[model samples]
Target: MIEHTALVVGGTSGIGLATARLLQQRGATVHVVGRTERKLDPELIPHWADGGDPAQIAAVVAKAGPIDWLVVSLSGGEGAGPIAGLDVATLRRAFDAKFWAHLTTVRAALPHLTPTGSITLIGAISARAAMPGTAGLAAINGAVEALVKPLAAELAPIRVNGVSPGLVDTPWWSGFPAEARAAYFAQMAERLPTRRVATAEDVAEVVALAATNPNLTATVIEADGGARLAALV
Candidate 1:
C-alpha cells in the first residue's frame, strides 16, 4: 500500500477523479484540484485552480504541500471539427487545456515532489491512431507523450510516465446525444480487438502502475484496447 500524499489536478471528474480514487484505495492521501466548478468527494481534500495557469498551479502545489505523486488529466477542447474549418480560437483553447496545463502543473509541482514521487500525464490514443476529426487532439496528445522522456531524465528518480487511453466511457462524451454517444461507443467496441471500450478504471489502473513502478520512466503506456491492431485488420 502506498502511504504517501498524491495530487490529481483536474480530479473533479472523469479520468482524473478515477485515478484519485484508485490512488486512495492504494493507501495514498489524495488531494483533488479542479479548474472550474466541480462536485468534490467528502473523503478527499479539495483544491481549486486552473491547470493551464502557472500561477494557479503553483498555488495548488503550495496548498497541497509535499506530494509523492501528481497526475495531470485535463481534457481537450470540445469544438474540434475538420482541420480546414477548425478556427484558431478552438485550437488555441485546446492547446491551453491539454498541453499547457500539463506543463504548467508539472513545473509547479516538481519542487514539492518527494524523492520517490511519480508524475503521470493523461494522454490519448489519438497520438498514434490516425482518425478523422482528431487533428487538434492528436497534436496535443503527441506533445504529452513526447515530454515523457525529457521529463523523466530531468526529474531523475521521480518517474514520469503517460497513460494513453482510447475511447474511454467518460463524461468527455456525455455532451453528445445519448443515442449518438451509445452508437459511437458501440462502433469503437466492435472495431477494437478487445471487443469493448475502455473504462475510467482501466486507465486508472495503468496510471497507478506507472506511479509505483521503479523501473518505469519516460514511458507511454497504451491502454487503447488494441486499437492499433484493429486498425491493421
Candidate 2:
C-alpha cells in the first residue's frame, strides 16, 4: 500500500534512480525529475527539468502536489581540482547544481510538504574529508551538508537530513575511460576499510532511512565506507 509520496529530484539515474526504485518498492508513490528523461520503471513517474532553474523546479513540485519526502540528489558537473588551479566557474556551477538547487527545491516544495514530512539532501564524502585535490567539491558539498541542522531546527516537525556518500560505482564516473575507472575504483576500494565501493542501492538504503524515519533529524549520515576516517588517519 502506498502510504506516502516522494519527490526525488535528479532521480533519473545513479543514486537518485536507485533511491526512487527503493522507495517505490517500499510502497511510496514516487515522482522523479532530471535534466533529461531516461527509461524507468513504469511505476516511477518522470518529469524533466534543470535542477538549477527555480521555475522548472517549482513547476515540478507543483505537479507533484503534496509530498511526504523531498530528496535532492542533483549533481553539478566536475569540480575537483587542486586549490592553486581550481576554476571559479566550475565552483559556481557546482554550487548552482547542488547547493542552490537544494535550497530552491525546498522553497518551492515547502507549501506542498506535509508538516511531518522529510527532506534528505545528498552530498559527498569530500565535504568532511580533507582531501587535497577535492577543494572545490568539498566546498560545494560542505555547503549542502551544512544546511541540515539549521533547516531541521527552523522546519521543526518537518525533518531535514543529509547523506554523504563515498566513492560509489555509478555512471557519475563514466567520464573516465572504462579501464582507468576500474583501476581507480580498485585503488580506492583498497584504501577504504570496507575494501569495496558501494553500490547505488547501498546509499539508497541510507537515504530511505533518512527520509522515512521520523525520529531522525538534524543529522548528516555518512555512507562513505569510512572514507572520512581513513582520510583523517
Candidate 3:
C-alpha cells in the first residue's frame, strides 16, 4: 500500500465503490467518478461523468490532477443469453458501455498518469469461463482482458493489469428478487470449491493489489470463487 493517488471510474457503487474505499483505507488519495451521484465519504473526492464519453472522462481526469492508479470497473449493459435467441443490439451496447469506455478512459488518463503508475481494468470470469449463456459477456470482457498484455508491453514502467471476477454478492444482481438471488447464491456456493460466493470487498482486495504492486504487470487476476473451474451445470 505505497502512498499514491488513484482515480476509479464507476466508483459510485458495487465493485468500483468497494475498490475506492479500500484504496482510501490504505492511505491512497482516492477520487471517484460515476454517471450518477451517491453518498460517499468526505475524504473521497467525487465527480460525475459517463465512462463512455471521452470528453467527460478527460474532464474528470483533468480535475483529479496526476494519478498513480487508474482503475476502470464499469458495468456494461447485460449480454447474457443463449446465442440462438441473442440480440446483437445487446452485445453492441455492452461493448459500447464497457470495452470502448475502458479504452476511452485509459486514453484520457494517460497524459495525467504518473510515469511509474498503474492501470487496472476489471473484466469478468465470463471472459475465460466456458459458461454457455455468457458468450456476449465473454466477448466484451475478453476484449478488455486482451488489452492488458499489449498495453502492459506498450506502457512499460507504467504497469497495466486486469481483474476477472466471478459471481460476487454485489448489487449487479439486484434485478433478481431477494429470495431468488439468495437461492441462486446458495446453489452456486454448493458447487464452488470455496463453498461461498465472493463479497465485493473480496474482489476489491485484488484490484488494490493490481493497482499497487509494481511487480505485477500484464496480469489478469481471477477473483471468482472457483466459478470458472466448476461445472457450468
Higher-TM-score candidate of 2 and 3:
3
The better candidate by lDDT, 2 or 3, is 3
| Superposed model 2: Cα runs more than 4 Å off | 231-233
**Distance (Å) between predicted and true CA of 75, model 1?**
1.5
Give the candidate order by descending TM-score: 3, 2, 1
Clashing pairs in 1: none
Q: Write the per-residue lDDT of candidate 2 for residues 1-233, one digit (tens) a residue.
A: 54899999999999999999999999999999999868999999999998778899899999997999999998866788898888888778778888888888888889999988999999999997998889899988999999999999999999999999988899898888999999888888888999889999999999999999989999999999999868532
Query: Can you write out model 3's per-residue Cα lDDT over 1-233, one digit (the tens) per residue?
Result: 35789999999888999999999988999999999889998889999999889999999999996999999998865788998898988888989889999999999999999999999999999998888888889999999999999999998999999999998898889888999999989998999989999999999999999999989999999999888889856
Instruction: Give candidate 1's total backbone clashes.
Output: 0
Candidate 1 regions exceeding 4 Å error are none
lDDT score of residue 219 within candidate 1: 92
TM-score of 3: 0.98
| Cα error, candidate 3, residue 98 (Å) | 0.8
Summarize candidate 1's per-residue lDDT along 4-40 as a digit string, tens digits: 9989998988888998998887788999988677777
Candidate with more favorable, higher TM-score: 1 or 3: 3
